[model samples]
Target: MKVSLIFPKLPETSTFIGTVKEAEKYSKDKIEFYGFPPMGILYLATYLREKNFDVSILDQFARGYSVERTLKWIKQENPDVLGFSTITTAGTGIISAEISRRVKEEINPNIKILFGNYHATFNDRRILEKYPFVDACIRGEGEKTLLEIAEKVEKDQNFEEIKGLTYRDNGRIVRNDDRPRIENMDTLPFPDRNLLGNVEYKNTVEGLELSVGKFTSAASSRGCAFQCSFCSSSMFWGKWRPRSPENIIDELSILEDQGFNNLLWVDDNFTISKKRLLKLSDLIRKEKFDFNWMAEGRVTQSSKELLNAMKQMGCKILSFGVESGSQRLLEWYNKKITLNQVYDAVKNSKKVGIDMILANFIVGAPIETREEIIETLNFSLKLDIDFPQFHILGIIPGNWIWDQMVKEKKINPDDCWEVGTAVLPIPLSEIMERIRQTHIKFMKRPSYISRQIAKTLKSRYRQKAVLQNIKNIERWDIWNSWKPFWG
Candidate 1:
């Protein structure tokens, strides 16, 4: 059967602006560097093709297609089954339902519509209840479930017996038993990069490429070993599992041969196991592979030796989730790492000549005071990091924080659609004001100001990028601030 898998275009208000227009506008007229392939759907398409089915991927986000354009394309494909790989961010999840509705009503009503990935996995019943256009949701890992659904549709069989599926029967919602997470990482086929079709992916620092050429993302492992309350990763991905070093390297070899010299390991926590990491680094160096890559590291697990070895393998950047500088808040979030660990990790990475150190901090968690927020910002300024990103905390669904918020009536079940679309009315004026002040203080540092001048004078691209970064700091003012979450 002909199948079409789509990654929907994000809402305009989405904080994530990876497309050309949004990226350029938000980056202060800098070069765009945010677009990346939807690896999930690509993997699904590969599995479907391996099963000898005709499959195609519509990467609306990467291609920057509009809702109308996406609908038009799906109508043209007219596949027997249409699947959307969705996420519960920036209202993309709710918007996916609308897109599905349009496909069912305006296009071929006979087509089976399926939604999968993080959002669908958690809110399967809600989706089936609210959006009649969506036929079913493939909860958790989707490869096996999706194949079974497609097979059923092809053979005109009922979906009643399918596990890991949530659908409607006789106007009543029916959610099947949950599917187990895929334990064997090597059993699955490589993501079908061919579905990407000339779509070039790259990783950049200060508007320059990470390596000599283009880059794409890969996963060395799945799930997080730590349980941070503000995160939904553990609930969705279950336990942490790493692929064999040989399996990871083999994929790297494929990408390198295909002219992708740089990679961004999108693992939830690549540094969870130091032994596996050192082994992987050794393999990369021993194989004589000349490629630059980046990965997220847990501060508690990072060490000087691991950072140094990763550097030897062309590790250009390492990101750390220093969620808050406040030790109290860190413990509240169950980060399980002290502020000292954060500092040491940064120091070690800097010593190893890691090109970039990107630290992520969340402002406005439960009971966070104005002073504590400033303390976090001040702590970030003192760190030996190249870049830092500050974002307002979200009460994500199905997380420990979400449950607490529900208990306190901070969130209402009726507002699920609103929350999914990121339209929840939470006033963040105080937080936004602090963000503005923090940016001003951070940017005014003598060394930072000097680096800005040097980089701006280096090239047109660098000038634009640096100026844009400066403008973004100013853009945090109340008038230009993002919507705040209300408790």
Candidate 2:
């Protein structure tokens, strides 16, 4: 069967915030050096192809296709089955549903529509119930599940026996037993990056395309050991599993040979284990490969020795999940580290000469007061880190926060598939205003300007990023108050 896997395109605009640079679209195009590859769908496509099925991927977000444009492509391809990889942000589920509905009702009634990824995994019953056009949801790791479903589809068979699937039965939704998580990371074939086509992916952190040259992303591991209240990482990817050092190095070597010199380690926390990271760093050095990489890490893992090893092995960017400034909020989020640890981590990262030190802070908790929000903003400003992203606390599904909201009747369980910002423990509008003010204050400082100039002189990558910012100076959405929270 001919299969088409798509990362649904973004809406033309959002009511929450404007783009960093105003354009006709709500997001930047890939040609503009923005966006990352939908690495998940690449796995599905490659796996299906290896099984002798004709498969293609349409990274709609990266391709910057409108709904009409995407449908046009779909109608032309007219694949036997249609699959979507969706996330919880920016109404992706809603968009994917619309596409599915139209495809079945308008394009082809016989084609099967399947959904996967975090959104589909958690809200399978809701999606199948609400959108009859949707054929099924492949929960969790889809490489194996999708292959089985595809074979069933080709044979005109029912998905009743397939594990990790939720589909319609006559008029009822039937959820099969979830498939176990893939335990062996090495067994899964490396995602064929060539399946990604000639598209150019860029690594831009905090509205800054700080990395130059060909850029893509890598996954050293899957899932997180710790469960942060607002995050769905642990739930979406059950438990933690790391690829061996040799396996990770092999992928990096292939990427280097593919002419990709920059990558973002997209693991939930790259430094979850200091010893493992040290081993990986040693292996990377031994390979003598040239790839500059970045990773999200935990403050508790910011040992000086680990930082030094990471830096020596070409880790230019190190970001920490400093979720909040308030100790109370941090604990409430189950983010075990302290504010002191955040400070120490940032300081050590800078001292180790990691080019970009980023801190992610989520403000406006359910019990967070106006004063507490400002305190967090002030905390971000005080940090020695170069980029700090302030997100309004959004309760996403399959997380502790979402469950709490549902229990308290703050959000209706069935209807609210999107991120819920109306908990109203603190008004979302108020938090957004505070975030805008903080961004303005931080960006307008002379010290920030001087830092930019100094960094621009030191690195050509930073120079290119700074030039992009300069060109968009008049249209910078920070002035228009671009609250970076997609949720």
Candidate 3:
């Protein structure tokens, strides 16, 4: 049996338009290239390969789309099954649908097409109804379920027995019972890195001095225990399941041996287990492994002692969700961390020489007063972190906040952006203007802007590039554009 997994490429501007400067600074391109290695697809590929299925992975991000070329490759390989992974909302789904349509129409009509990931998990019914080219959609974690489905498809067996799958039966959508989440992550084989050929890791952006080589991402756990209303992890994974420290260390050792020097722990919350973290740190230290790692966790999860120990154990960076500065807003969002925790965590991280990135405020949230927005900005600036990202509030389809806002008459169901995937009723002009004003206010702070400008100057090589960016901002009038909204 032969199986193929495809990660459809998307326009760089679509993904990183708001953060172009940051993207360019970190990578050689003006956009954040690639979709972070499509870990889910790789996991499924590994499972199929281990089961003796001929599996191949294609990343459209690195390889630009040429329908003729892709179709030619498909025809030449002639895989028995095809699978696509998608994210929340229509962005990835639309791309997957187009590819599926092309395959059905141009390449091979008989090839079984399947979809998985967050979007399919939540919007299976809608997808089935709209895109008939997709033979099935897998809900929730697909590593095991996908293998079962692939076996059935390969053998021409009944697919109804497969759990956690939605498929068309006699012109009706049939959704099978949900599959149980995998508890033992250790049993799963390490991801198939052969899928991503010639992997190189530098900050990718022009001016950054940090060149941690051939970094690979690994998930130490699944799900989040906290109730962050805007987050989809809790809804997707249901409950938290962490891999043992030994298992995690084993995988790290594998990656290290494979010439990957930097590791990114891609868990929703890596700091959930202090004991496990300390144990892993101790093991890394004991093994004398030379690698730098980064992870995202709650702001309050680490202490000065634990952070210091993490640095000693080759942890170079820490990312935290300091969503808002306003205590009231934080409480409303169910972040569960106090303002003091943010301050202390930043202080401790700085003291330990660990780079820090704060996921900052979500602008234009319902009932959000202008004062609260300013307060959030002030809090972000007060932290004095190495990097901060301010994002507009997007009500993703599966999130609790998305449903709640709709129920409360806060979000207009018809309003959408980013090719109808992002929910934003507010005019784009208004949102962009607010962002520009926020940027100006953030840059006005000499201490903060100086570091940011210095970083940009250091990262950018060609003077023309910097000037062009400045000219682009000037033409856009990001600061002054908010006048219509103010009135």
Instruction: State each model's CA lDDT, in order.
Output: 0.77, 0.80, 0.71
- Write one digit per residue (lDDT tens) for candidate 1, span 329-378: 89889899999999999888877767667899988876777678888988
Better of 1 and 2 by lDDT: 2
Total clashing pairs for each candidate: 4, 0, 8
Question: Model 1 residue 86 lDDT?
Answer: 79
Return the lDDT, model 3, position 477. 34
Model 3 ranges off by over 4 Å: 11-13, 17-35, 199-211, 409-428, 440-446, 449-487
Candidate 2 lDDT over 382-458, as tens digits, reads: 88778788776767677999898888887787666753444645667777777877877887789987986786688
Output the better candidate (2/3) by lDDT: 2
Report lDDT (Cα) of residue 473, candidate 1.
45
Worst 10 residues of 2 by lDDT: 14-23
Off by over 4 Å in 2: 13-33, 451-487
lDDT of 3 by residue, 1-487 (tens): 7998877655443543121223334445423332245688888899888998899887654455455666677777788888888765436677778878999998889898998888788778888888889889999888889899788987898689999999988689999999989888788888977775543333322122232456667888888888797778887887888888888788878888888876777899888888888888898889888886777867787787788778878776677889888888788788888999988888787777664344556765675677776677667667867655667676776677878876886666445311333345456566667665665565567888676666456533223335644645432334433343333
- Over 4 Å off, model 1: 21-33, 204-212, 417-427, 449-487
Ranking by lDDT: 2, 1, 3
lDDT of 3 at 4: 87
